[model samples]
Target: MNFDSYASDVMAATVEAVNQLTPGHARGRDYPAARPDLGDLVGEAAVSSEDVDELRAYAFKIREIFVAVDDNRIDDACEATNTLLAETQAAPTLSRHGGEPWHLHFHTPSERWARGWAAPMATALAIVLGNPMHDRLGVCTATVCDRVFVDVSRNGTKRYCSTACQNRVKAAAFRARKQV
Candidate 1:
């Protein structure tokens, strides 16, 4: 049930990055934003208005890649994935930062926000590729929602992104049965 330590860290970071970009909980929930420049693991830099829009679009693109991976479409999934990987120049290494001990690192020093995202994402996927658990990357099947997640559970049986959605679907099923 254990994954590579490096890959595990990268996956955790990828999830963290996505969460930073679009928090999973209710909208407008107050949470600390990622600071990519201040040497924080989640750095913070001034993002332009246009950059915000671009990031949102890129998030959806990432979600699409996850969906492709889940559907067993390797060519389509890797197409989008390779674009991200090539753009970011993701490389693997072990380094220490922020007083932490040596750990796997996967980013070059760059000020661009896109590079900040691409590096970590590509590194995370690389970890998945190296291990058999690459199948963990997937999108939720909830209608009207397309959020991505890394299934880190021991049972490998995660489906929805949150309890609210699970409840929503359950309630719909109950209502249908009652009507019948």
Candidate 2:
């Protein structure tokens, strides 16, 4: 099966959800506006404000996984992910929907909004951490940003979460050089 697509897509959505749903530099942003993209992770699932709040709590847990990885605490990351996997009761299943071809999915018995999304996300993350490419997951290195990302670049050298953050750092360095 296409594990790469699963890992990349879920991880990207995880990043978006965490950045938009949780507080930090991206706090003041609108989660509702970002729902379209986030919806890819949970198709057609109904979510309410209380559901969003639960998701916001899940966001914090996901962020901890990224922080552990970024901090070079691989064991901690794995343990945290394992805890989430157990909590969410994530299990693999074959699902075909919307006339799409049959493919793999991680499912949880709980119909709760947070666990619904958390199961697949945690499953994708477990797949990565179980492999050598676990380092591909990371929290943005920008001091001003706590965003998380999956480094899918060919060289796997990504540090910043986005080009905007990369450019901001570059511009700051240029200004510093001029002053020096």
Candidate 3:
């Protein structure tokens, strides 16, 4: 299930950024009002207020992709992905930062959060579309929970974010079958 090393890193970072931007327990904090750290990832490009708005929209779009996948609505997921892909222009290159080795990268020179996110996200989608890994994008199966994950596992079999959620789902299912 390994993609190209650089693509894997970029996808990993993309997932992290999505999690950071989205409200969730995994982050251990509420979503920030201002994410200066996002600017670092996007580079020194000009980011407008509109760009931030758009980024939020796209974050929700990513959320929709997860929900659609959970519902087994592949058409909706594909449509959402196409919308994101249309908004992005990802080109791959190599760069070094934070003492990390040179790696495959994709970006635009915009400082705006949404614009900055577009390229990397688009690149991640490209990897997913090109490889079997695309099926890995999914939502948690726990009842009353809606978290997303990119299951980059050898078995393509990740169903929940934590054991707690797994147990919750199992318990719920057991109760449902008993009532039936």
lDDT of each: 0.62, 0.77, 0.65
Q: In model 1, what lDDT does residue 11 have? A: 63
Candidate 3 clashes: the total is 3
lDDT of 1 by residue, 42-96 (tens): 3556667566555545555666667777898767877777787777677666777
lDDT (10s digit) by residue, model 3, range 1-180: 767776666666666555556664442224453552454555666666676567666676677776776677777777777777777656666777779997665664333466556677766666665565667777666665455777877898988866777877778789999999
- Candidate order by lDDT, decreasing, is 2, 3, 1
Report the lDDT of model 3 for residue 103. 65
Reference-based TM-score, model 3: 0.65
Off by over 4 Å in 3: 23-54, 93-102, 110-113, 170-180
Candidate 1's C-alpha lDDT? Answer: 0.62
Local lDDT at 69 for model 3: 62
- State the displacement of the C-alpha of residue 157, model 3, in Å, after optimal TM-score superposition: 2.2
Model 2 TM-score (2 dp): 0.85
Ranking by TM-score: 2, 1, 3
The RMSD of every model to the true structure, in order and in angstroms, is 5.2, 3.5, 5.2
